[model samples]
Target: MSGPVRSATTPSNPTDASDPPTSLNPILRGFNPDPTICVVLASGGTPTIFFLSTSTFEYFPGCAIYTSTDLLNRELIGHALKRRSQIELRTVKPGADSWASTLRYRPDEGRWYLANCLFQRYRPASDQRIFPRGFYVFTDNIWDDNAWSDPVYFGDPGFDQDLFWDDDGKVYLSTTTRLSDRAPDSTQKDLAIHISQMNICTGRTLTPPVVIRRSPHGIAEGSHIIGRNRIYHLFTAGGGTEAGHQGPDAPAMLLRRQTSFFQSLEVTMEFSTQQRGA
Candidate 1:
């Protein structure tokens, strides 16, 4: 589940009218899993930069950040969580501290937001509910590590949380529901995805959570919502987390919503699938 970031792109200047594209694979090396990348437009004389942030579980500076002007070369700029006051992991279980994160740059707000969850004190036998808290940290400047504000904690919905901005000036929070958080009689597996309107600045939920999609397998996480051409595209990872047991049931689904996101929409396609031999 851990590897480098690979990229395939054509040359900056195409020399011929008809030529095959070139590829630069493994652009960023090291164990960078559950990575989120975005393009930041250039301001003033600076070149447009591609920013990347990856999950750093149990690491001191959580959520390593990288930036690149071109797709070939990348630099480790800083981290989203740098200070001790930002995140505390004294007694957190190993390999279960910080989970997947969503990195975004808002042009209107002129800021960068990193949303993630902490799976700190999970004692299932004791039924203690003091783990899996979702929070976000913001920074006006991505280059400055100290500029990231303290985490604004939103109530724990689940892991692999996503922050999405709608056209009507509303921010929506999407996440996979944890099995422990469900009701006693609830039939939801570890695959349910929920959406809710939220106050992004204050980390406050403005509406009740709605069940959107449940994966066919028992696990569904890493869901992202993007809007284009008046249609909202939901890209979600469905199946097991590990590699050996993924089998033929593991597929990445693409669901589309033409109207409001709250409306019911059918699954449009099973866009990508990973099997044992495929």
Candidate 2:
């Protein structure tokens, strides 16, 4: 279910070399953001793709799901959170309900898992305060509207949290953490990518957070882990998402680890622009 970082390049024109090419139209319109997709293989060897997009600060139904068999056409399936017990957002701000989310399927368990980060200022109906919290839900059947389980809150690993299930039945959660919080004046880096063993069933951390990679260009977020060719690939989007920003120089970076996932040795890949100062 893991793959390489998606390309942002627009295709070249098929008619003429001098003419500009068009990009694929948006499959899901509206305010959906931070989309995470997973491909599921059925018993008959058919591939079913599922997509989950962030519905930040939206109503009761937070994250939206879409299903596609051909990858080109997608159909609106259902929302993950339907009941108020799943997510209570009446007291939350307009744009602070939920953030980037990831959809993952566990073959052994025959279930689908959805992990998302919730941005809340304070605890509901209490003076106690809490930072951002990440939570996950699972469903035995993705096609059913009421199949998803209740939200299981986990620790705050910041935004764009991802779930990676290894071949050995170990589950890991990867996200961006602030290095400045530990060392404010440290010039080595400001943000770092951290990973920790997670008990997906109970939403608990099995080990302490381990710093796998530090951002060299800018703040790292939107992290995802994939294993291919016996190597674990950690892909992240760095810099900023704004236009004319540091992100242009290096919008994405990839790190590869062999033998062990705890090793800090990394190979950073910088994105290259096709043209400059045109």
Candidate 3:
């Protein structure tokens, strides 16, 4: 989906987020791949929501910070940690490993870490087997100091890592474990969900591995625990990628309508999920 991406900061030669007119169906435009979102209850009954966008291709991480009195049409407060992330991007793509991502916050340790995945020949758009486990960079108070912490690589999980926060002040990792094409069915475990506890605050992994959800089509690559209307909703995205990645040009994209909105993954593997369990 292409949406209007308004930007005041462009790397060197700034390009317009939109061409001439706004797009009709702008879903995830702005060259934003991995989207991490957080809703913070600010003082005076206000809520601030943050969305971070990364262009792993360019080896840069960029994000937009939006605030709201209501959830729809979140007001932009400018790009979140733009200057810091830009500088970090200059050196963050260490070696030949391209990056991938997921987002979450750690309450027990009072810090936030942007969970990411990286590897050699990392741009799976051309090939998929070369991906490797990656790291997390602790998000500092960049709003004030305009500085950043160094990225800390946490070693391989024997799989990829996408950070998920639980309800009881705990954090964890989830991902598609073994990427395979062999299946009795059309999908197999091709797109699966694996779970493990994470000490993200201390840059540690605290649990063994387990596969939680799998489907012929796919399970959402990301998950979140949030409170709304006095209840918790599990938000996730399932089955969607640009056609270029699926067959013709890029090997990364899979063809499926992306499901959005919230669901309940509190205790069971049930969901009012937008488009899943296919």
Candidate 4:
């Protein structure tokens, strides 16, 4: 279960309170967590619309999707995983189902994509929770419940998986990898961000996965990449998403590529602390 949803917007004049920017704390009330949102501008006579999707751990219909026009009022259009053939949850741990999903619009493809990972079935001998491959589903009819296609699986065993389509028409996948996966001596809780070129249609990796950056503090996940002005930026959370560890290290980090691609990345800035289920 999750808490209420709220957003804050700042006005141009900080002193202006007469008709100040207003928002409703818990605008969306219920068990909606790790919400990923995108906006589709008006085109071809279609009106502009905002789309949103949230993680639904151990729950049927995996990711819940919604749509809005002004970002306030929302409507439950459908879900990304609505059919039984789309997912299997019998072995999923109680609270470890589908989480940290991203929903994005591929303008060139004229379709929407939802990338998610399912954590299910634990390995008692190794004491490691096995992730059943990262997968993504696509849909052209946003409002139709049965429009989403079956998942296209990729061999990335990580959480908070994200998909980015670069300007050159190349698709990139980003996700977390436990430090222990590389250095067996390191703590398993520590995670590093990784990126790879993948075929969005077939879920095939074109390039070997590259470790872009390591978590600055405790853990790093929820990575998103975007390109603009001939520059690619990578955003991730650090320190820890859990509570009680809120401090200087708990801020979200911003890193950008040194060149046109993911050859090199450098830390450029840092932002607010992240709290899990808070």
By lDDT, the better pick of 1 and 3 is 1
Writing each residue's lDDT as its tens digit, candidate 2 over 1-278 gives: 11222212353766666765443546455556777888777667766565555555556577887776655556667788887778877777665677778888877788988888666663345422244668888899987769999888776456568899887878888876665355644543356677888887777888888877666564667788888555777767666454523454445556665766777757676665643221
lDDT of 3 by residue, 115-140 (tens): 55544343345333454565665654
lDDT of 1 by residue, 118-184 (tens): 8876445544345466899999999889999999988646788999987878898998775445557
lDDT of each: 0.76, 0.69, 0.44, 0.76
TM-score of 3: 0.56
TM-score of each: 0.83, 0.79, 0.56, 0.84
Ranking of all predicted structures according to TM-score, beginning with the best and ending with the worst: 4, 1, 2, 3
lDDT minimum window of 10 residues, candidate 2 = 1-10
- Model 3 poorest ten-residue lDDT run: 247-256
- Where is model 1 more than 4 Å wrong at Cα? 1-21, 24-27, 121-131, 179-189, 244-251, 272-277
Model 2: residue 131 alpha-carbon error in angstroms? 3.4
Clashing pairs in 3: 1-27, 2-26, 2-27, 3-26, 245-253, 246-253
Best by TM-score: 4
How do the residues 172-278 of candidate 4 rate in per-residue lDDT, one tens digit apiece? Answer: 89988766555666554566788889988799888878887676564777888877655777777666565624645444556564554566677776654443333
In order, what is each prediction's RMSD in angstroms?
4.5, 6.1, 10.2, 4.1
- Counting only residues 3 or more apart in sequence or on different chains, how many pairs clash (N, Cα, C under 3 Å) in candidate 4? 0
Clashes of 3: 6
- The candidate, 2 or 3, that scores higher on lDDT is 2
